[model samples]
Target: MRHQTYGKLAVLAFALVLVSFVILGFTRAIVGFRTARLLAAPTTLLAASLVCLLFVRGLLAWSGLRPLE
Candidate 1:
C-alpha cells in the first residue's frame, strides 16, 4: 500500500520526526553547551522524536485494520 493511504496527519507526524532528528544533531554539535538546562535540548528532542515515530506508526497500523461494526 502507498503511504498516502495512511493520511495527511501521518505525513505531518513523519516530517516532525525527521525535523526533530535534524534539530537534535544541531543541538549536540554546539560548543560549551554543557550547562544543565542547555544540556536538556537534545534529550527532549530525542523523546519528542520517539513519540512522533510511535504516533506515525500507530496511525499506519490503525489505518490497516477493519472494524466489524
Candidate 2:
C-alpha cells in the first residue's frame, strides 16, 4: 500500500513538473522573461526540491532500502 501510494505521488509530481516546464517555456517566449523572472524564485525552489527527491529515490534504490520498512 505504501509503495503504491508513493508511486502515485511520484507520477502526479512528474506530471505537474512537466506541465509547469511547458508553461514556463511558453510564457517566457511569448510574454517575456522580465515577467517570468517574477516566477523565478518559486520555480527554482520547486526544481531543487524535485532534484532532491530524485536523488533520494536513486539512493534508496541503490541501497535496496524500502522506505516504509
Query: On a 0 to 1 TM-score scale, where does candidate 1 land against the true structure?
Result: 0.42
lDDT of 2 by residue, 1-69 (tens): 256765775676676667667767877987888776555546556766876776687578668784533
lDDT of 2 at 30: 79
Candidate 2 collision pairs:
none
Distance from true location, Cα of 45 in model 1, Å: 0.2
**The candidate that achieves the highest lDDT relative to the unseen native structure:** 2
> Scored by Cα lDDT, where does model 1 land?
0.57
TM-score of each: 0.42, 0.54
